[model samples]
Target: SVDLWKEAAMLVPEYFENTIDIWEECDVHWSPDLEFDQAADPAGAYADLSSDMTKSNSYRSWRKQLRDFIYRDVTLPLWQDETSDLYSTPEETESGFRMRVVQAIREQNDLEVEKLKAKFKSKFESQRDRVLRAEEKVKREEAQYKEKSYMSLVSIGSSILGALMGRKIASQTNVSKGATAIRSASRAAAEKADIQLAEDKLEQEQAKLKELEIEFDAEVEKLEQRIAPDSIKLEEYPIRPRKSDINVADVALLWMPFAIHANGAKEALFTINE
Candidate 1:
C-alpha cells in the first residue's frame, strides 16, 4: 500500500512566511552551509513531519511534495534579491570586495571567450580556403603535367621511328655510314633519357602533392583542436549548488506489503510444481 500526504496545504504557507520574514528582516548573509542547515533543520515543518519518529508513510510523501513548493515559493525569491544586492552592500568587507572583483573578472573572461571564438572562426576559414586552393592548384598542375608527358612520349616515339626509317633507307640505298649509325643510336638514347626525365619529374610532383596533403591534414587537426568545445574554458564565479547538495534523506517506509499472503501463495504454488 502507498500512502499519500499533502503537506503543502497544511505547512508550506507558514514556512514560506517564516522564510520571507528571514529574508526581509535578517541582516545576516546566509552562507551555503547555513542555508543547508536551516533547510534540513528538524524544526522545519516538512523535516519535523518527515522525521523517523513519524509512524505514517504519509509524512515521507509530504516531504517530497513540500520540497519544490518551499524552494519555488521561498528560496528562489530570496536568492534573487540577495544576488541583486550581493556586490552593493554598504559594508565593504574582505569577502564582499572579493566577490565584486570576482564578478568583474568573470565578465572579462566572457569577453575573452567571445573574442577567442571569433578569432578561431576566422583563422579556421582562412586555413581551410588556403588548403582547398592549394589542393585545386595541385590537381590542375597534375592534369597539365600528365597531358604534357603524353605529348612528350609521342614526340620521342616519332623521333625514334623517323631515325630508324632513315637508317633503313640509307642502308637500302648503300649510303649508310658508321657515323650515321652512331648518330641514330645517340638520338634514340636522348629520347629515352627525355622519357626518364619526365617520369622523374612526375614522381617529384607526386611526392610534393603527398607532402602537401599531409600538411593540410595536420593543419586541419590543429584548427579543430583550437575550435573544439573542450578546448575553451569559461570562468565560473563561486560554485553553484548541485542537486545532490539539496537532497534531504527520506526516512519513511513508503512501500507496505498489505497483501503479503497473495505473494506467498504464488511462491508456494511455483515450489509445488517444481
Candidate 2:
C-alpha cells in the first residue's frame, strides 16, 4: 500500500511570477513507519529521511521540468474589471510610488525643521535681549559707582586735611582742645567709615553682576543646545505606508506532491496547477 503524506501548503502570489524563479531546492520528508519494499533489507530502509531534491540529478531534472511547465503552460487569472480597486494603473508602479513617498517625507521634514527653527529663534532672541539689558545695567551702575566713589574720596580727604590743619593752628596758638576741634575730628572719622562702607557695597554689587553674567551665559548655552542640528532626527518622524501604495490582487495556497524511492530517486507527480 502507498501511504499518502500531507505537507504544508506554500503561499504563492498570483502576480509577479518571476519572483518564484529563484527557487533552487525543495524538502521532501518520508514517514518513519513507512517501509521501502524495494530495499535489500526492508527493516533497515530509510524510514525517516529528509532529502534535498536538488541533491539528485533525477530530482533536479524533475523540478526543472515542473518549473518550465509553470512558466510556459500555467495560466494565472488576473482581475479583468477596470473599476476594481485591486487593479494597479501604469502610473502606480512601485518606483513611482517610492519617489512620491520620498518627496512627501522630505517636504514634511523641511516643514518640521522650519517650525523648530522659528521656535528656537524666538527663544534665542529673548535670551539674548535679557543678557544685553543686564550687561547695560551693570555697566551703567559701574560708571555711576566710580564717579560717586571718586567724589566721596576727594571730599573725605579734604575734610581730613582741614582737621589736621586746624589742630596744628590750635597747637601753634597755645589754645586748649575745644568743642570745635573735637567736632571736626568726629566728622572726619565718620567720613572715613562711610568710605569703607561704600567700598563694601560696591564689592557686593560687582559680585551680583558677575553672577548675573554667569546665569545669562547658561541661558544662551541652553538655547544653543536646542538649535543644534544633531538635536533633530529624521527617524523621530515615521512615515506610514498609504493605503493606495499597497494593492493585493489575490492569495493562494498551493500544494505540491513528490515521491521519493528507496534508491534516492525522486519524482514530482504533477505541475503547479495540480
Candidate 3:
C-alpha cells in the first residue's frame, strides 16, 4: 500500500505538470491517532468544506478549483466497488465520480429552479387575471359611456328643439326675451356640465385600465427573463449541500499536493489526488 501510494504521488506531476507546475520534492504524512471511516463520502465532505470556506477568507482564489478536484479528479481505494480492482488509476475512477457529483448538483439546482419558476408563474397568473378584470371593466365602462352619450345626445337634441319651440311660442305671445334667454342658457350650461363630468369619469377609468395593462406587461417581461431556459446557467447556480446535510462521521481528512503559480498579476492554485 505504501509503495502504491508513492507511485501514485509520483504520477501526479506527469498528468498535471503542464497545468500545475508541481514542486519536485513531495512529502507524505499520516496520522494514526485519527480514526478514518472505511468509506469516504465526497459530497458530504464537499458540503462540510463549503460551509467552512464560506466562514473563512482562506482558499478564496482556488475554492472552485479545489471543489472540482474533489468531485471530478480525486480517487480513493476505499471509494471503489468490491468487484473492482483495488488499485485503479485516476482515469478509471474519474468518470464515475464526476457523474455522481454532477448528478447530485444538477438535481439540487433543478429543484430550486422549479421552485423559482413556480413562484414566478403564480405571480404572472395573478397579474394576468388582474389585467383581464381591468380590461373587462374598461370595456363595460366604455360600452356604458357610449350608450349614455348616445342617449344624452338624443335628449339634448329634443331639449334644444323644445326650447326653440317654447321661445317661438313665447315670442308670438309677447313673452319677455330676457326671461327666455336666461332659461335657455341655464339648461344648456347644466347639460354641458353633465356631459363633461361623464367624460372625465370615463377618462379616469381608462387611465386606470392603461396603468394596469402596463403593469401586466412589465410582469410578463420580468417572468420571461427569470424563467427562460436559456437564461438559466447550471454552473452559475449555488447547488452546494447545506451544513446540516453532511454527517461529520462520514468525512475523512486527507492532505493533497497543490501547485501555486503566478498567471500575470493573479496567483492560482491547482491540486491532484493520489
Q: Best candidate, TM-score-wise?
A: 3
Per-residue CA lDDT of model 2 for 41-152, tens digit only, reads: 3333333322432246444544464445334433222221211122323324544434444444445556665666665666556555655655565565556556655655
Question: lDDT tens digits, residues 73-115, model 1?
Answer: 3321111113223332233454445455456545655566566
Q: Rate the local accuracy (lDDT) of all candidates.
A: 0.42, 0.44, 0.43
TM-score between candidate 2 and the true structure:
0.32
Provide the lDDT at 102 for model 2: 48
Rank ordering of all candidates by lDDT, starting from the highest: 2, 3, 1
Off by over 4 Å in 3: 1-103, 167-274
In candidate 1, what residue range of length 10 has the lowest lDDT sum?
265-274
What clash pairs does model 2 have?
Answer: none
Error of 1 at 175 (Å): 19
Write one digit per residue (lDDT tens) for candidate 3, span 91-129. 345445434444444565567657666756666666556
RMSD of candidate 1 to the truth, in angstroms, is 18.4
